[model samples]
Target chain A: TQLLEQSPQFLSIQEGENLTVYCNSSSVFSSLQWYRQEPGEGPVLLVTVVTGGEVKKLKRLTFQFGDARKDSSLHITAAQPGDTGLYLCAGPFTGGGNKLTFGTGTQLKVEL
Target chain B: DAGITQSPRHKVTETGTPVTLRCHQTENHRYMYWYRQDPGHGLRLIHYSYGVKDTDKGEVSDGYSVSRSKTEDFLLTLESATSSQTSVYFCAIRGIGDQPQHFGDGTRLSIL
Candidate 1:
């Protein structure tokens, strides 16, 4: 069973559009991370939110952690074709060494 | 891809055959993990290694075995390949037991 659930399994949008992806879970996590994976490449870490109610930004990407650390969200402001890829949200093991339980990935396609 | 590397970038094998995937890291990370990615299911943890000769099973450990004989290497084995086991496998390395992980390019395996 997947601990984290992502909304809109697949998405297609034009460039400059704003989009948001959600990652929800019932269990509290020590930390949650967002990663983007391109074809034939492994996932590249985007951001990690360790504290509840924390927000981080990277270029045009914004990430927020839930107040209870049970959920997280990734919002891309003005999406671009380069942003097209699989976005995965993962949570580290609650009690152990960095073993992550990943969410049911969100596939995004941005058209230029 | 990070300092971690997964060999046999692509493989096609017949059912019931045995296969092994290697994950090598140059960063000497203490924690290493193996995960499989499939459509809709996202990436699920199959196994992980915390130290030399210390490995543990994850939620999806059935039929998959792992080993860590050294700090720089982790191996995953499929005793008998099956159609259901066809997926892209990824290797991850982390500096500590609870930090963000770096991943390799992944191995695409096909079971016919």
Candidate 2:
């Protein structure tokens, strides 16, 4: 079973549009990470949030960890075609010794 | 990709056959992991190693085995390939501290 769940399994939008993807979980996590994966390439780490209610920004992308540490969100401002790819959220498996459990992915397509 | 490299970028095999994927890292990271990505499932951990000759199973360890005989190499073995096991596999490594994990390009495997 997947410990984390992502909404909007697939998304398509025009460039300059804003969007947000969410990752939710019932169990609390010590840390949460977001990654972006392009076709034929492995997922690359984008950001990591360690504290609850913490928010981090990378370029036009903003990431927020839920206050309870059980959820997270990624918001992209003025999306571009280059932002098209799969977005995945992952959290360390509690008591699993650094093992990470990934969420169902969100495939985003940005059109020009 | 990062310093990590996964061998056999692409492979085709028949069911019941055996296959092995290699992951080599040059950064000398102590923690290494193997994960498989599929539609909707995002990335699922297969196995991981914390040190030489020390390995552990992940959420989807069935039909998959792993080894870490050295600090720079980790091997994933599929004793018997199955159609369900066909997917893009990724190898990742994390160094000591709060640094995020780095991923390899990944190996695309097909089981007929």
Candidate 3:
């Protein structure tokens, strides 16, 4: 089974701080996706990275895929209280079906 | 916001009782998935359906079953509720091809 592991399971930071969350896997994936879930709500898709060493930016958030397609990272710059939520990374095995394996998740709390 | 909705946003029941959670989508997506979020486990896929009357189990499917009789609805059933099964459930839908999946608000189930 393909597994994605996220580091820094819990994070607490003050507003304007910067943080980076990492996701690693032993198996290679064809593509990787990042999601942010708020309390009492389901996860929302943040971005999908498919190329090795690719980087995508969404305002203050920057996402990068590993050079080997075995890892990914999300970096948030000038984090605000609204950035508090659970961050998850997911991917499908190279040849696996449509099913996606999700990471353990990183819970972030940005205080004012 | 991908036109997905989960019924019974909150449910409280006793052990050994049968529970069914419903997922409805208006996007007419070809794939629907059910997942449970726990403290340390993140979001684990319970079941997924690729088409009408076609479904498959995920990593954690021992006590769960799923049915997709129509393109817009996917149902998850817990044969016998257990305290360990209490968690927040989410439903997601993916359109054809490799598009990212969209999710619903989720259902909170408590098994006492």
- Taking all chains together, each candidate's TM-score versus the true structure is 0.96, 0.97, 0.97
Query: Whole-model Cα lDDT per candidate?
Result: 0.91, 0.93, 0.93
Q: How much is B23 displaced in model 1, in angstroms?
A: 0.9
Instruction: For candidate 2, write residues A1-112 as lDDT tens digits.
Output: 4389998899999999999999999999998999999998888889999999999999999999999999999999999999999999999887757678999999999999
Candidate order by decreasing lDDT: 3, 2, 1
TM-score of each candidate's B chain against the true B chain: 0.96, 0.98, 0.98
Specify the CAPRI tier of model 1. high
Give the Cα error of residue B75 in candidate 1, in Å.
1.1
lDDT of 3 by residue, B1-112 (tens): 6899899999999999999999999998999999999997889999999999999888899999999989999999999999999999999999888788899999999999
lDDT of 3 by residue, A49-103 (tens): 9999999999999999999999999999999999999999999855666888899
Docking class of 3: high
The DockQ-based order of candidates, best leading, equals 1, 2, 3
Model 1's DockQ score: 0.93
Name the candidate that leads on DockQ: 1
Task: Please identify model 3 stretches exceeding 4 Å from their true place.
Answer: none
Q: Which pairs of residues collide in candidate 2?
A: none
DockQ of 3: 0.88
* Candidate 2 residue-wise lDDT, B1-112, digit = tens: 4688899999999999999999999998999999999898989999999999999989889999998999999999999999999999999998877778889999999999
Residue B43 shift from truth in candidate 1, angstroms: 0.9
DockQ of each: 0.93, 0.90, 0.88
